[model samples]
Target: MAIGITAVAVPLANADVTTKANPEGIDVSSYQGSINWSSVKSAGISFAWIKATEGTTYHDSRFNANYTNAYNAGVIRGAYHFARPGNSSGSAQATYFASHGGGWSKDGKTLPGAVDLEAGCAGLSQSSMRNWILAFYNTYKSKTGRDVVIYTTRSWWSSCTGGWTGMGAKSPMWVAHWGVSSPSIPAGFPTWTAWQFSSTGRVSGISGNVDRDHFNGSAARLLALANNT
Candidate 1:
């Protein structure tokens, strides 16, 4: 999630290739406070992933406003869950996410829900962590009829899941590697579907630091993803 983390300047040499072709976006949580979606859209932001739920019981306090306002302002938006593997079963957390705000719809402005998979591996071994993630994906799919996006980093994926490659074919990857020319693709994915390039970004509507991202393709491709076309 990169919340509360120090931001590093992303190198222009590395970011130019992706940002030039990809749609600019951001990910926000309650930490971002109130946002002006119209200004965000006017500032050339195209999409967002807002924090929805974490673990099994904690819903992001600002989720509803962020989700609805982003959509109303014409920014393609989606919800994400911060995973908690050690506290409960993956299925439980996915169920909680879907019921809260992470459920997907066919509307052209809503992206499929994502699961944030970082923060110390949740004390699980590689194999257990892999199983837990698969369970969450499967449960979320069954509930929403859409594949859950996997949000992670190369180092975390490698260390926690032993570089598992099974998810590449089943889900889209939102790889996060801050301050880089290009994000490193995790083991299971050949390429990133979305890239979080910097955590210290300044967007028009967001008052504090926000995580900046890019959809790996054009705007139409992003629409296709949102609509599952």
Candidate 2:
């Protein structure tokens, strides 16, 4: 139902996205330990995607604290996962997000939510792997009534998610591809909603490098992801 094209400035790239400009967000991982919340607040980071869980049993010690800090500072916030360990573990991680970050306002909008799946954790058959990923996706959908964006590499996007739209056709996508000025998204894939183009980004609060994200829609669309709208 949402449509348009915008070139989000990512320290790189101009892909085919629907909306005004690419929205800017950050994916914070353990790399951002001992953060200076004040510096992050001052850096004008419009949004943050924090690591919530790793496997079925491992959770980020900093997720709750980071979420609270971002919320307090009025930075739009969301959560993501390190997926692809296996299907069973994928389902477990999804459940983790549902219990922790899936709730929405009375109006039923949520902060943006995502699942970061890649090859190489414990590589299983593709079908089995997708089934496991779907288990989590289905749960998140049931809880939020909104699609959780899927983040994966260009290669994976081409081969993995090409045939699946089990979540919904209108759900947004977040693509991860490093290097080059910009990379075109694979054909058959819906337009991108977020582009994670760098793992070497330097932000004020972080000591080491951080992954930088760009939104493909307007400020309003991001608010929708945040469920603020």
Candidate 3:
């Protein structure tokens, strides 16, 4: 049986308590102003994970347009993927990301670019899929020289990522395991820098809804993440 939760869109009165550990966030498709960004800013929302590129043929239409709004509101923002499945080895998807990632610059603040791998795609071998991911990462890095972050569940990390110990330095991790507390991150997988804990979260200042995220360290640490990378 599935558990039920009665959720309301609460303002960040106790944001310090709420945005703790792997804090609250919403994974959004569009903005409608349903969430209160002022309250979110006042409430201390740590970060936002926005949808950027998807398949080679499709990208998030609203990402670049909306990211600036979030940034101006003092929200640290990141981007995610929807995985092209069989086409993971294609360069088009990478190019799409490279073109539409708002052009990250030196000393210009931008969240790490991330690849969201899931079971949405079919008919691709593990090697083929990994090749697709590498293609995107390699090509994008060649243009930007920035490392790419990987967003996956624990199971995907184990089966698809091979052993985390062997991952290249260009890869960081964003593990999704929504629950009350942060879950056990895999050892060979790598150190997860962010955790998605609750999808049921509601923050002020966003329209319709948004995904709330927490940097896996103190606010000081988060500053380091933003300034360094």
The top-ranked prediction according to TM-score is 1
lDDT of 3 by residue, 1-229 (tens): 0001122332233122232544444455544433444566676775666777777666676776657666666666666666775754546666777677624553223566677776643666557666777787777667666666777777775566553444434576667777657655643444567776666665655544444555565543443344442
Model 2 segments more than 4 A misplaced: 1-20, 85-89, 106-110, 119-121, 159-170
Q: What TM-score quantifies how close candidate 3 is to the native fold? A: 0.76
Model 1 per-residue lDDT at 16:
19
What digit string (tens of lDDT, one per residue) describes model 2 on residues 114-217?
Answer: 78877553556657655776777777777766567777766774466554555335446777878866655644456777788898988897798888888776
- lDDT for 151 in candidate 1 is 95
In model 1, the runs with Cα more than 4 Å from the true position are: 1-20
- How well does candidate 3 score on lDDT at residue 191? 58
Q: Please identify which of the two predictions, 1 or 2, would achieve the higher TM-score against the true structure.
A: 1
C-alpha TM-score for every candidate: 0.91, 0.79, 0.76
Model 1 C-alpha lDDT per residue in residues 35-100, reported as the tens digit of each score: 999999888898899999999989999999999999888888999999989999999999999999
Local distance difference test, candidate 3: 0.58
lDDT of 1 at 206: 84
Error of 2 at 192 (Å): 0.6
